[model samples]
Target: LEEETEIASWTENGGLFVGTNAERLAEYKRFAETGKYFGIESHVLSPSEVKEVHPLLRIDDIYGGVYSPGDGTIDPTSVCNAYAKASRKFGGGVYENVGVSGIEVEDYLTAGSAPGRRIKAVLTSCGKRIETPTVVNACGAWANEIAAMVGAQIPLKAMKHAMVLTEPIAGMHSGLPNVRDHDLSVYLKTQGDSMAIGGYEQNPEFWPDVDPGFAFGLFELDYDTFGQNLAGHMQRCPVIEETGIKSTVCGPESFTPDHKPLMGPHPGLRGLFHACGFNSMGLMLGGGVGRELTKWILTGSPEVDLFSFDCARFHPESVASSRWVRDRTHESYAKTYAIVFPHDEALAGRGSRKSALYDELKSRGSKEPLDYDLYGACAESGLAFWLVDQGAYEEGAWRLGEADHPDIPKHQSHEYLDLVEGELTFDWPASHATVAEECRAAREGVAIFDQSYFGKFYLSGPEADEAVQYLCGADIEGKRAGSVTYTPLCNSRGGVEADLTVTKLQDSAGSNYYYFAAGGNTATKDLAWIRKVLEDQNFKAQIEDQSEAMTLISVQGPSSRRLLQSLTHSDMSDESLPFSGAKHLEIAGHPLLVLRLTFVGELGFELHTPAESAVEVYRAVQEAGAKLSQLEGIPVRDAGYRAIDSLSAEKNLRHWHADLSNRDTPLEAGIGFTVLSKLKRTGS
Candidate 1:
């Protein structure tokens, strides 16, 4: 942009991040290592070295710091003007002070004869109608409102952010680098002749109802909230105390639930795209975002892994609730500078969506003993389980053991207090032993897991098989009924778009259908990709989202067959339902589609049943397993996501969004076996 527009909107004064605590310093050291891996220039500085970079900082209390010479600040207003000028030079018209009143949408058929919605036009408040087939909703704080006009939704909310400016100090200059005291959630930079200080507070003020005409508007000085950071600012820069306060700037900034920007095409709409919800980093990420969005608009997909920022990542049900969006957004904003733990889960917006077994799972955490020996053992061991929102559905997590710290208060029903009081560290947690036992059960005896959060979908019609063969990297062609194929769906660049399993099934009428099971969090994203491919190819296939309609229960271990065989009349032999085979059977008097697949590298069966019957079926399985446990003297346990992670990691399994993503190809991910030899030879 700088070269094209010839605008000087950036200041390359470098940046410094200082830590006052050991933990923060350790975090900085790890970040420096990561920067090295990425070939980014960064230096871990000592107190004296940090003083050399910025003499104004009182580094006496600082433990350590990291300095990156490439880090700098951009003037947002100037950058926007430059982009507008560049757009005009490229023959694009720029409009300002115009508000979107409504969006006109119409039903249309794709090239493949599939039903879809397209933008017909956009109506503006200035009595002008723009005739366009695509509309990008880039209205930062008003993004949700604009989306609502088109019957779409994006999970974003605007919150008030404040920054204070001090009268010029004698030694302050433009050359001083931008400095951040992340431990104190405060940042400082030189703004011309003065110093500007800003912070992220624990409790931020939300603007639920932003005025329609509040563009580029500032709110009155929030002294109460802005004052909280003044002490930290003074301690870091002692000269700030002597200088008089110049002015305070407070404005609304849009934030998302996970603190990542909302980008990519809307899943339900054909031509509607999202490029907002930057969480106060718009100025820094704007250029990159603009480039990626442009590429996506022209080519149907972005060039890199953007699933983390995809607007479809959140379940519609969770984002539809204003209360849930507000709570999660608040949590995301507060943790802007907090240390990120690998295993940490959000505490807000719990139970937004739940499986049929949600209540039963919560009951297992109770202190009161039930009829089952498992419950009795849990009570004795002070084991308390908690559920986390996975793909919006409440999935069970590791059970907590007795609190390592006795001073922590205990709840009457469960031990959530332990989670609140226990310090989160990089080392093993108190629940490690409990998770080990669960893993043991899965490896030895028997373990049942409620995996209802898996995203389920169906593709049917005469062209279903053709679509699958084209989209999947595996050789799924000519696969017989009851065959399950684990495949990687790749993009045009051969990057893994999704890692999932596709099972071929036949209806009573002999029509073929395909069942797709994907990671819970990537359900919407995967669906969007499938629909896009189908439409682009003009394939005569119909896609259905059954994620919320079906529930998945997994039974694994060496004794799994014996335990399941005792409950049903269907054949449980390997010859009848071999590995990678799927069949519809009557299990515990309920009809279920069972697949012989294992993510934990064990003999396992995944039973996909109707969501309404999941609780009863799960209870029956638990009861039968308990009876078998008593007879065989082998433990039968209920496992959670943590145990699943441990067992899968033991087998070196790759998890989506963690070990595998859209940025990696199957060959690079060590899963080249899934790709067809023909495609590899042809370099397709």
Candidate 2:
């Protein structure tokens, strides 16, 4: 353009203002190096290459490095004028020297369930209150100060930096490309006709303290400490030495504790948005950040995944442990231009893989099915197991041993049993309500829960009851037809063996029955002993093991009563038979034991049916209660069976090994009258 110009002027040195950054060049190098450590498959310029590629002066410490041909520089004063002209042409608001005093924050709260909050406007120093539905705070280093007015902690801080510009040294290809590299932590190259060089190496601690009042005076450089650092860089990079000491400038950088930009809502504050704290990457990532910032102001999060920068995640506690994150962030301000990362997310450091349990659980369902809960467990089942296994035996023994139930294994290697305990100790009214709602669902309609491991027993032929009665030490002579007996089976040595429920059957013959025990494997093991005893006695009873053939599902809800009442043609109510009582009914050619036993304390019935019919029965019950609970809005009480069992035991409803035992005598165990007198007559 100078060749064709009639009037033209050229100056090697130009007025430059990073406005907010003086250049913490060393910090910029670190930030850039970390990215190399964990590299991105993108291109950036290197300092050594910058010296060699441009035919300016003698080069030194030259090595394979980052290069970008499109890099250039400018006079901030001229650029500001250009921007002002563009704004005037576009009719955009331009406020200079006028800073924001107070932001008039108004939240137009439309009452919601919890009232999701938002920000309405930001009033500036010009007494101009920008009225809008959404507000964005792009005040850079002062973001936190402004954000606090809107009820948000911005996780932002201010930093000062310095950059050096060398004297004019004309050479072929007069202006060399702007270059950046991390090897020596410096970016060196051109500034118009002069070598506009900079170093992010200003030792923040060694330099004279900067007065916050004189922030924009970039011409005031850190003369002493920065001079020493600049000398060393010039010694290594010969190009900077050829055109050394043009001028020095300083500016501020905004940062989050994590060294990343903060760009999101002001958390608890409604409609208030943020796009500040770029450290020094603001200009580099500006276009992307700006677009997202606008989107984020409208929506809580930008489409480009900005979760990492949301200030809410930092809170006041998380980053409190490490001061490095804060310090490093400040060091990498405008003057530094440091590589923001250390290792290649690919190569520089460590690597890991998922645990076996997590792999299995994740693959088991469409998504990870086992809910250990991130809020509560904060990890996978394996992680939980690790914590539990650490002091399992010791903690278990301490708490349970004090309660007199030493049956829990001791805190020894072999004795340490793996158990996942999640019940909260404190009371929650909502939890109780959930339990009641579950029970209510069961009673009114059908609710099928996990009873895959429920213990069951099957007995057949003429003398099944004889063997059962002898094994249980209970008299079945008066066990009413179609009735079930709550019997306490015992070991011959006289301790309560297992708590069993035996249902009676006539079947066109004399009375016969089988026992179903309470404890999971305990009942099965006890029944195994009964079969062995029958064989030892040479008894003619036939024992068919039915534990696997059946899975006892309790359809105990109000719906349970209605469905069973319709299925069996029998009415079940508190008046007809008490909670512990039972009845046999025929449903579509299948024989079922309908018992009024509820673990949840709900008014419901349990249908003891074959495992094959479980799905069918479950569907039928679910269908019956579909209109009652699962329909979503029906107001109903629920009783969580698990909670009921725990709470019931606490309330002393039915004892497991206690009331039905010979270990402490029936009276001591709390149930004495259930023992029959006829058993004394049959002493043989």
For model 1, how does the per-residue alpha-carbon lDDT over 358-409 read when each residue is reduced to its tens digit? 6677676622111111000011111233433221111111121112234433
Q: How much is 81 displaced in model 2, in angstroms?
A: 4.5
Q: Going through the candidates in order, what is the number of backbone clashes in each?
A: 1, 70
Against the reference, the lDDT scores of all candidates come to 0.79, 0.48
Evaluated at residue 44, the lDDT of candidate 2 is: 30
Number of the top-ranking candidate, with TM-score as the measure: 1
lDDT of each residue in 168-203, candidate 2, tens digit only: 665624445554443345555555566555555534
In terms of lDDT, the best-performing candidate is: 1
- Runs off by more than 4 Å, candidate 2: 1-52, 56-60, 74-90, 106-110, 113-117, 170-174, 205-215, 242-244, 299-303, 307-316, 319-325, 328-684
Scored by lDDT, model 2 comes in at: 0.48
TM per prediction:
0.91, 0.42
Candidate 1 lDDT (Cα, 0 to 1): 0.79
In model 2, what lDDT does residue 326 have?
Answer: 37
